[model samples]
Target: MNWFMEFLATGFYSGKLPKMPGTWGSIFAAVLAYFLWPSNPDFQVLVILITFFLSVVSSDYLARKLGDKDPDQVVIDEVLGVEITFFLLNPQGDLELTLAGLILFRIIDIMKPFPIRLFERLPGGWGITVDDAVAGVLANILLRVIGGFL
Candidate 1:
Protein backbone atom coordinates (compact mmCIF):
# COMPACT_ATOMS: atom_id res chain seq x y z
CA MET A 1 0.00 0.00 0.00
CA ASN A 2 1.08 3.59 -0.59
CA TRP A 3 0.74 4.44 3.10
CA PHE A 4 2.81 1.47 4.19
CA MET A 5 5.68 2.30 1.87
CA GLU A 6 5.55 5.87 3.00
CA PHE A 7 5.69 4.77 6.58
CA LEU A 8 8.77 2.60 6.04
CA ALA A 9 10.39 5.22 3.85
CA THR A 10 9.91 7.76 6.60
CA GLY A 11 11.14 5.36 9.22
CA PHE A 12 7.96 3.71 10.38
CA TYR A 13 5.76 6.76 10.54
CA SER A 14 8.38 8.57 12.58
CA GLY A 15 8.39 11.55 10.22
CA LYS A 16 4.81 12.18 11.15
CA LEU A 17 5.18 9.86 14.05
CA PRO A 18 3.56 11.20 17.21
CA LYS A 19 5.40 13.02 19.97
CA MET A 20 9.12 13.50 19.38
CA PRO A 21 10.29 11.76 16.23
CA GLY A 22 13.94 12.15 17.17
CA THR A 23 13.43 10.75 20.63
CA TRP A 24 11.25 7.91 19.40
CA GLY A 25 13.72 7.11 16.64
CA SER A 26 16.53 7.06 19.16
CA ILE A 27 14.60 4.64 21.34
CA PHE A 28 14.13 2.36 18.39
CA ALA A 29 17.76 2.75 17.49
CA ALA A 30 18.86 1.82 20.98
CA VAL A 31 16.86 -1.35 20.79
CA LEU A 32 18.45 -2.13 17.45
CA ALA A 33 21.92 -1.45 18.77
CA TYR A 34 21.37 -3.94 21.55
CA PHE A 35 20.81 -6.59 18.94
CA LEU A 36 23.30 -5.59 16.25
CA TRP A 37 26.49 -4.65 18.05
CA PRO A 38 28.88 -7.46 18.57
CA SER A 39 30.36 -8.42 21.92
CA ASN A 40 33.75 -7.52 20.55
CA PRO A 41 34.58 -3.94 21.30
CA ASP A 42 36.41 -3.28 18.06
CA PHE A 43 33.64 -4.54 15.82
CA GLN A 44 30.92 -2.78 17.72
CA VAL A 45 32.83 0.47 17.61
CA LEU A 46 33.32 0.16 13.88
CA VAL A 47 29.67 -0.56 13.27
CA ILE A 48 28.64 2.37 15.41
CA LEU A 49 30.84 4.79 13.54
CA ILE A 50 29.70 3.55 10.15
CA THR A 51 26.07 3.67 11.08
CA PHE A 52 26.36 7.20 12.40
CA PHE A 53 27.94 8.39 9.18
CA LEU A 54 25.34 6.76 7.02
CA SER A 55 22.47 8.11 9.08
CA VAL A 56 23.84 11.63 8.87
CA VAL A 57 23.89 11.52 5.09
CA SER A 58 20.57 9.77 4.66
CA SER A 59 18.22 11.35 7.22
CA ASP A 60 17.91 14.62 5.33
CA TYR A 61 16.66 13.04 2.14
CA LEU A 62 14.29 10.94 4.15
CA ALA A 63 12.94 14.00 5.89
CA ARG A 64 12.35 15.77 2.60
CA LYS A 65 10.54 12.84 1.04
CA LEU A 66 8.19 12.73 3.99
CA GLY A 67 7.19 16.35 3.36
CA ASP A 68 8.08 17.75 6.74
CA LYS A 69 10.83 19.58 8.53
CA ASP A 70 12.64 16.90 10.43
CA PRO A 71 9.56 14.77 10.68
CA ASP A 72 9.22 12.75 13.86
CA GLN A 73 8.97 9.49 11.94
CA VAL A 74 12.26 9.87 10.14
CA VAL A 75 14.10 8.63 13.19
CA ILE A 76 17.00 6.77 11.61
CA ASP A 77 19.32 9.52 12.74
CA GLU A 78 18.31 9.14 16.34
CA VAL A 79 18.46 5.39 16.08
CA LEU A 80 21.93 5.50 14.59
CA GLY A 81 23.13 8.01 17.15
CA VAL A 82 21.87 6.01 20.07
CA GLU A 83 23.46 2.92 18.61
CA ILE A 84 26.74 4.77 18.43
CA THR A 85 26.39 5.80 22.06
CA PHE A 86 25.81 2.26 23.27
CA PHE A 87 28.50 0.83 21.04
CA LEU A 88 30.98 2.86 23.04
CA LEU A 89 30.18 0.71 26.04
CA ASN A 90 30.63 -2.57 24.13
CA PRO A 91 27.92 -4.19 26.24
CA GLN A 92 27.97 -7.71 24.82
CA GLY A 93 24.19 -7.53 24.76
CA ASP A 94 23.89 -6.89 28.46
CA LEU A 95 20.85 -5.01 29.70
CA GLU A 96 22.82 -2.79 32.05
CA LEU A 97 24.89 -1.21 29.31
CA THR A 98 21.83 -0.82 27.13
CA LEU A 99 20.01 1.00 29.92
CA ALA A 100 22.96 3.19 30.75
CA GLY A 101 23.52 4.11 27.11
CA LEU A 102 19.84 4.86 26.70
CA ILE A 103 19.85 7.22 29.66
CA LEU A 104 23.07 8.92 28.64
CA PHE A 105 21.99 9.37 25.02
CA ARG A 106 18.64 10.77 26.05
CA ILE A 107 20.16 13.17 28.52
CA ILE A 108 22.78 14.53 26.16
CA ASP A 109 20.27 14.64 23.31
CA ILE A 110 17.89 16.69 25.40
CA MET A 111 20.59 18.98 26.71
CA LYS A 112 22.10 19.64 23.26
CA PRO A 113 25.39 20.87 24.60
CA PHE A 114 27.49 23.44 22.77
CA PRO A 115 28.16 22.38 19.19
CA ILE A 116 25.41 19.84 19.33
CA ARG A 117 22.94 22.68 19.18
CA LEU A 118 24.94 24.24 16.40
CA PHE A 119 24.87 21.04 14.40
CA GLU A 120 21.10 21.01 14.59
CA ARG A 121 20.98 24.39 12.91
CA LEU A 122 22.54 23.05 9.77
CA PRO A 123 20.40 22.99 6.63
CA GLY A 124 18.32 20.04 5.51
CA GLY A 125 19.00 16.44 6.53
CA TRP A 126 22.53 17.18 7.68
CA GLY A 127 21.12 19.59 10.19
CA ILE A 128 18.52 17.14 11.29
CA THR A 129 21.03 14.33 11.77
CA VAL A 130 24.20 16.02 13.01
CA ASP A 131 22.77 17.09 16.33
CA ASP A 132 22.04 13.51 17.27
CA ALA A 133 25.50 12.46 16.08
CA VAL A 134 27.06 14.98 18.38
CA ALA A 135 24.93 13.78 21.24
CA GLY A 136 26.01 10.25 20.46
CA VAL A 137 29.66 11.24 20.50
CA LEU A 138 29.37 12.96 23.83
CA ALA A 139 27.46 10.06 25.29
CA ASN A 140 29.99 7.64 23.85
CA ILE A 141 32.87 9.47 25.46
CA LEU A 142 31.15 9.49 28.82
CA LEU A 143 30.23 5.86 28.49
CA ARG A 144 33.76 4.90 27.53
CA VAL A 145 35.12 6.78 30.52
CA ILE A 146 32.74 5.01 32.85
CA GLY A 147 33.54 1.75 31.16
CA GLY A 148 37.20 2.23 31.89
CA PHE A 149 36.49 2.45 35.60
CA LEU A 150 34.17 -0.54 35.74
Candidate 2:
Protein backbone atom coordinates (compact mmCIF):
# COMPACT_ATOMS: atom_id res chain seq x y z
CA MET A 1 0.00 0.00 0.00
CA ASN A 2 0.94 3.61 -0.52
CA TRP A 3 0.88 4.27 3.19
CA PHE A 4 3.34 1.49 3.85
CA MET A 5 5.71 2.61 1.11
CA GLU A 6 5.46 6.18 2.33
CA PHE A 7 6.23 5.11 5.86
CA LEU A 8 9.36 3.28 4.70
CA ALA A 9 10.43 5.98 2.26
CA THR A 10 10.03 8.64 4.89
CA GLY A 11 12.24 6.76 7.31
CA PHE A 12 9.33 5.90 9.55
CA TYR A 13 8.00 9.48 9.30
CA SER A 14 11.14 11.01 10.73
CA GLY A 15 11.45 12.81 7.41
CA LYS A 16 8.17 14.54 8.09
CA LEU A 17 9.74 16.25 11.06
CA PRO A 18 10.31 19.94 10.57
CA LYS A 19 13.85 20.96 9.56
CA MET A 20 16.75 18.73 8.56
CA PRO A 21 14.77 15.55 8.09
CA GLY A 22 17.79 13.77 6.71
CA THR A 23 19.65 14.32 9.94
CA TRP A 24 16.70 13.06 11.91
CA GLY A 25 16.49 9.97 9.77
CA SER A 26 20.21 9.36 10.08
CA ILE A 27 19.95 9.64 13.82
CA PHE A 28 17.04 7.28 13.83
CA ALA A 29 19.00 4.78 11.78
CA ALA A 30 22.01 5.07 14.04
CA VAL A 31 19.91 4.59 17.14
CA LEU A 32 18.06 1.66 15.63
CA ALA A 33 21.30 0.12 14.46
CA TYR A 34 22.84 0.61 17.86
CA PHE A 35 20.09 -1.41 19.49
CA LEU A 36 19.28 -3.96 16.82
CA TRP A 37 22.40 -4.69 14.81
CA PRO A 38 24.42 -7.67 15.95
CA SER A 39 28.21 -8.02 16.29
CA ASN A 40 28.66 -10.31 13.30
CA PRO A 41 30.36 -8.74 10.29
CA ASP A 42 28.40 -11.05 8.00
CA PHE A 43 25.16 -9.94 9.61
CA GLN A 44 26.12 -6.32 9.25
CA VAL A 45 26.73 -6.78 5.55
CA LEU A 46 23.43 -8.54 5.15
CA VAL A 47 21.59 -5.77 6.95
CA ILE A 48 23.25 -3.13 4.84
CA LEU A 49 22.41 -4.96 1.64
CA ILE A 50 18.80 -5.36 2.68
CA THR A 51 18.50 -1.73 3.71
CA PHE A 52 20.02 -0.62 0.41
CA PHE A 53 17.48 -2.63 -1.51
CA LEU A 54 14.57 -1.27 0.49
CA SER A 55 15.91 2.25 0.12
CA VAL A 56 16.05 1.97 -3.64
CA VAL A 57 12.60 0.47 -3.94
CA SER A 58 10.92 2.82 -1.54
CA SER A 59 12.74 5.87 -2.86
CA ASP A 60 11.79 5.13 -6.43
CA TYR A 61 8.18 4.64 -5.44
CA LEU A 62 8.12 7.81 -3.38
CA ALA A 63 9.68 9.80 -6.18
CA ARG A 64 7.07 8.59 -8.57
CA LYS A 65 4.27 9.34 -6.14
CA LEU A 66 5.57 12.77 -5.22
CA GLY A 67 6.60 13.68 -8.75
CA ASP A 68 9.99 14.80 -7.59
CA LYS A 69 13.43 13.55 -8.50
CA ASP A 70 14.34 13.33 -4.83
CA PRO A 71 11.70 14.38 -2.40
CA ASP A 72 12.78 15.71 0.93
CA GLN A 73 10.34 13.30 2.51
CA VAL A 74 12.31 10.34 1.26
CA VAL A 75 14.90 9.96 3.99
CA ILE A 76 15.25 6.22 3.66
CA ASP A 77 18.32 7.03 1.61
CA GLU A 78 19.73 8.82 4.61
CA VAL A 79 18.85 5.86 6.77
CA LEU A 80 20.65 3.53 4.42
CA GLY A 81 23.60 5.89 4.29
CA VAL A 82 23.90 6.01 8.04
CA GLU A 83 23.66 2.25 8.30
CA ILE A 84 26.51 1.96 5.85
CA THR A 85 28.44 4.48 7.90
CA PHE A 86 28.58 2.21 10.91
CA PHE A 87 28.88 -1.01 8.88
CA LEU A 88 31.12 -3.50 10.70
CA LEU A 89 32.38 -0.92 13.16
CA ASN A 90 29.37 -0.16 15.33
CA PRO A 91 28.25 -3.69 15.95
CA GLN A 92 29.16 -3.43 19.61
CA GLY A 93 26.52 -0.70 20.05
CA ASP A 94 29.07 1.76 21.36
CA LEU A 95 27.35 5.07 21.78
CA GLU A 96 30.50 7.06 21.06
CA LEU A 97 31.22 5.27 17.80
CA THR A 98 27.60 5.53 16.71
CA LEU A 99 27.56 9.24 17.40
CA ALA A 100 30.81 9.75 15.53
CA GLY A 101 29.58 7.82 12.54
CA LEU A 102 26.33 9.78 12.51
CA ILE A 103 28.14 13.11 12.55
CA LEU A 104 30.67 12.11 9.92
CA PHE A 105 28.03 10.66 7.65
CA ARG A 106 25.86 13.78 7.87
CA ILE A 107 28.79 16.04 7.06
CA ILE A 108 29.95 13.95 4.10
CA ASP A 109 26.39 13.61 2.80
CA ILE A 110 25.75 17.32 2.99
CA MET A 111 29.06 18.20 1.37
CA LYS A 112 28.67 15.64 -1.44
CA PRO A 113 32.19 15.94 -2.78
CA PHE A 114 33.64 14.36 -5.95
CA PRO A 115 32.07 11.14 -7.19
CA ILE A 116 29.58 11.26 -4.39
CA ARG A 117 27.80 14.12 -6.10
CA LEU A 118 28.11 12.39 -9.44
CA PHE A 119 25.97 9.50 -8.23
CA GLU A 120 23.02 11.85 -7.93
CA ARG A 121 22.90 12.15 -11.71
CA LEU A 122 21.81 8.57 -12.07
CA PRO A 123 18.16 7.89 -12.90
CA GLY A 124 15.35 7.21 -10.44
CA GLY A 125 16.09 5.43 -7.17
CA TRP A 126 19.81 5.15 -7.88
CA GLY A 127 19.98 8.90 -8.39
CA ILE A 128 18.43 9.38 -5.01
CA THR A 129 20.40 6.73 -3.15
CA VAL A 130 23.94 6.19 -4.49
CA ASP A 131 25.23 9.62 -3.51
CA ASP A 132 24.35 9.05 0.10
CA ALA A 133 25.72 5.53 -0.06
CA VAL A 134 29.07 6.93 -1.22
CA ALA A 135 29.00 9.48 1.56
CA GLY A 136 28.36 6.72 4.07
CA VAL A 137 31.28 4.67 2.77
CA LEU A 138 33.56 7.68 2.91
CA ALA A 139 32.50 8.41 6.45
CA ASN A 140 33.06 4.79 7.46
CA ILE A 141 36.53 4.81 5.91
CA LEU A 142 37.34 8.01 7.70
CA LEU A 143 36.23 6.49 10.98
CA ARG A 144 38.39 3.46 10.33
CA VAL A 145 41.41 5.69 9.61
CA ILE A 146 40.78 7.72 12.73
CA GLY A 147 40.49 4.55 14.78
CA GLY A 148 43.72 3.27 13.30
CA PHE A 149 45.57 6.37 14.43
CA LEU A 150 44.14 6.39 17.93
Candidate 3:
Protein backbone atom coordinates (compact mmCIF):
# COMPACT_ATOMS: atom_id res chain seq x y z
CA MET A 1 0.00 0.00 0.00
CA ASN A 2 2.81 2.41 0.77
CA TRP A 3 4.52 1.42 -2.45
CA PHE A 4 1.41 2.15 -4.46
CA MET A 5 0.91 5.46 -2.68
CA GLU A 6 4.50 6.39 -3.28
CA PHE A 7 4.20 5.51 -6.94
CA LEU A 8 1.18 7.77 -7.31
CA ALA A 9 2.61 10.56 -5.16
CA THR A 10 5.76 10.59 -7.23
CA GLY A 11 3.86 10.91 -10.45
CA PHE A 12 4.97 7.44 -11.55
CA TYR A 13 8.58 8.29 -10.69
CA SER A 14 8.70 11.41 -12.77
CA GLY A 15 9.08 13.24 -9.46
CA LYS A 16 12.18 11.19 -8.66
CA LEU A 17 13.94 12.50 -11.75
CA PRO A 18 17.04 14.71 -11.48
CA LYS A 19 15.33 18.11 -11.23
CA MET A 20 12.09 20.05 -11.79
CA PRO A 21 9.94 17.06 -10.94
CA GLY A 22 6.76 19.08 -11.15
CA THR A 23 7.67 20.18 -14.65
CA TRP A 24 8.45 16.61 -15.60
CA GLY A 25 5.18 15.39 -14.15
CA SER A 26 3.25 18.06 -16.00
CA ILE A 27 5.04 17.17 -19.20
CA PHE A 28 4.17 13.54 -18.72
CA ALA A 29 0.55 14.50 -18.11
CA ALA A 30 0.50 16.74 -21.19
CA VAL A 31 1.69 13.84 -23.35
CA LEU A 32 -1.02 11.66 -21.92
CA ALA A 33 -3.58 14.42 -22.42
CA TYR A 34 -2.56 14.85 -26.02
CA PHE A 35 -2.82 11.19 -26.80
CA LEU A 36 -5.65 9.99 -24.61
CA TRP A 37 -7.89 12.82 -23.37
CA PRO A 38 -11.56 12.29 -24.05
CA SER A 39 -13.50 14.46 -26.49
CA ASN A 40 -16.58 15.12 -24.40
CA PRO A 41 -16.30 18.07 -22.03
CA ASP A 42 -18.35 16.24 -19.41
CA PHE A 43 -15.96 13.34 -19.39
CA GLN A 44 -13.05 15.73 -19.34
CA VAL A 45 -14.42 17.44 -16.23
CA LEU A 46 -15.12 14.08 -14.65
CA VAL A 47 -11.56 12.97 -15.21
CA ILE A 48 -10.16 16.20 -13.82
CA LEU A 49 -12.34 15.97 -10.73
CA ILE A 50 -11.33 12.35 -10.10
CA THR A 51 -7.67 13.16 -10.56
CA PHE A 52 -8.10 16.11 -8.22
CA PHE A 53 -9.48 13.85 -5.50
CA LEU A 54 -6.72 11.29 -5.95
CA SER A 55 -4.01 13.91 -6.04
CA VAL A 56 -5.17 15.36 -2.73
CA VAL A 57 -5.17 11.94 -1.09
CA SER A 58 -1.89 10.76 -2.57
CA SER A 59 -0.02 13.98 -1.97
CA ASP A 60 -1.26 14.17 1.61
CA TYR A 61 -0.10 10.64 2.34
CA LEU A 62 3.28 11.22 0.74
CA ALA A 63 3.79 14.54 2.52
CA ARG A 64 3.06 12.94 5.89
CA LYS A 65 5.36 10.04 5.12
CA LEU A 66 8.19 12.36 4.10
CA GLY A 67 7.57 14.81 6.97
CA ASP A 68 7.69 17.73 4.61
CA LYS A 69 5.37 20.52 3.69
CA ASP A 70 4.71 19.95 0.02
CA PRO A 71 7.59 17.67 -0.73
CA ASP A 72 9.40 18.41 -3.97
CA GLN A 73 9.07 14.80 -5.08
CA VAL A 74 5.30 14.63 -4.77
CA VAL A 75 4.01 15.75 -8.16
CA ILE A 76 0.58 14.26 -8.45
CA ASP A 77 -0.51 17.85 -7.99
CA GLU A 78 1.28 18.80 -11.14
CA VAL A 79 -0.42 15.99 -13.02
CA LEU A 80 -3.81 17.20 -11.88
CA GLY A 81 -3.00 20.80 -12.73
CA VAL A 82 -1.87 19.99 -16.25
CA GLU A 83 -4.95 17.89 -16.82
CA ILE A 84 -7.12 20.81 -15.77
CA THR A 85 -5.27 23.12 -18.09
CA PHE A 86 -5.82 20.81 -21.05
CA PHE A 87 -9.46 20.29 -20.16
CA LEU A 88 -10.12 24.02 -20.35
CA LEU A 89 -8.00 25.04 -23.32
CA ASN A 90 -7.30 21.96 -25.37
CA PRO A 91 -10.03 19.46 -24.72
CA GLN A 92 -9.86 18.38 -28.35
CA GLY A 93 -6.17 17.51 -27.91
CA ASP A 94 -4.65 20.11 -30.18
CA LEU A 95 -0.90 19.65 -29.92
CA GLU A 96 -0.18 23.35 -30.20
CA LEU A 97 -2.71 24.34 -27.57
CA THR A 98 -1.66 21.59 -25.25
CA LEU A 99 1.94 22.73 -25.52
CA ALA A 100 0.89 26.27 -24.84
CA GLY A 101 -1.08 25.17 -21.79
CA LEU A 102 1.88 23.20 -20.50
CA ILE A 103 4.14 26.20 -20.70
CA LEU A 104 1.58 28.52 -19.16
CA PHE A 105 0.86 26.16 -16.30
CA ARG A 106 4.57 25.75 -15.52
CA ILE A 107 5.11 29.48 -15.49
CA ILE A 108 2.11 30.30 -13.35
CA ASP A 109 2.94 27.47 -10.99
CA ILE A 110 6.48 28.67 -10.53
CA MET A 111 5.52 32.29 -10.12
CA LYS A 112 2.76 31.50 -7.64
CA PRO A 113 0.95 34.81 -8.01
CA PHE A 114 -1.47 36.20 -5.39
CA PRO A 115 -4.04 33.71 -4.09
CA ILE A 116 -2.20 30.90 -5.78
CA ARG A 117 0.43 31.10 -3.09
CA LEU A 118 -2.30 31.47 -0.51
CA PHE A 119 -3.84 28.12 -1.39
CA GLU A 120 -0.61 26.47 -0.32
CA ARG A 121 -1.34 27.54 3.25
CA LEU A 122 -4.20 25.09 3.51
CA PRO A 123 -3.78 21.95 5.57
CA GLY A 124 -2.64 18.58 4.28
CA GLY A 125 -3.54 17.57 0.72
CA TRP A 126 -5.47 20.76 0.10
CA GLY A 127 -2.27 22.70 0.35
CA ILE A 128 -0.42 20.33 -1.93
CA THR A 129 -3.13 20.23 -4.55
CA VAL A 130 -5.21 23.44 -4.69
CA ASP A 131 -2.36 25.78 -5.51
CA ASP A 132 -1.54 24.00 -8.73
CA ALA A 133 -5.20 23.73 -9.63
CA VAL A 134 -5.50 27.48 -9.18
CA ALA A 135 -2.43 27.92 -11.34
CA GLY A 136 -3.97 25.67 -13.96
CA VAL A 137 -7.18 27.65 -13.92
CA LEU A 138 -5.22 30.87 -14.25
CA ALA A 139 -3.09 29.45 -17.03
CA ASN A 140 -6.16 28.30 -18.89
CA ILE A 141 -7.74 31.73 -18.57
CA LEU A 142 -4.52 33.46 -19.51
CA LEU A 143 -4.12 31.29 -22.57
CA ARG A 144 -7.66 31.90 -23.67
CA VAL A 145 -7.22 35.61 -23.22
CA ILE A 146 -3.97 35.48 -25.17
CA GLY A 147 -5.61 33.45 -27.92
CA GLY A 148 -8.37 35.97 -28.20
CA PHE A 149 -5.80 38.63 -28.95
CA LEU A 150 -3.86 36.56 -31.47
Q: lDDT of all the models against the reference?
A: 0.71, 0.89, 0.89
> Which lDDT tens digits does candidate 3 get at residues 34-141?
888887889889999998988999999999998998999999999998887876455445888888888999999999999899999999999999999999899888
Off by over 4 Å in 3: 91-93
lDDT of 3 at 115: 86
Worst 10 residues of 1 by lDDT: 2-11
Provide TM-scores for the models. 0.76, 0.96, 0.95
For candidate 2, the lDDT comes to 0.89
Ranking by TM-score: 2, 3, 1
Clashing pairs in 3: none
- Model 3 TM-score is 0.95
Write one digit per residue (lDDT tens) for candidate 2, span 72-136: 98999999898888887754568888888888999999999898999999999998989999999
lDDT of 1 by residue, 115-145 (tens): 7998877888778777877888899899888
lDDT of 1 at 77: 70
TM-score winner, 1 or 2? 2
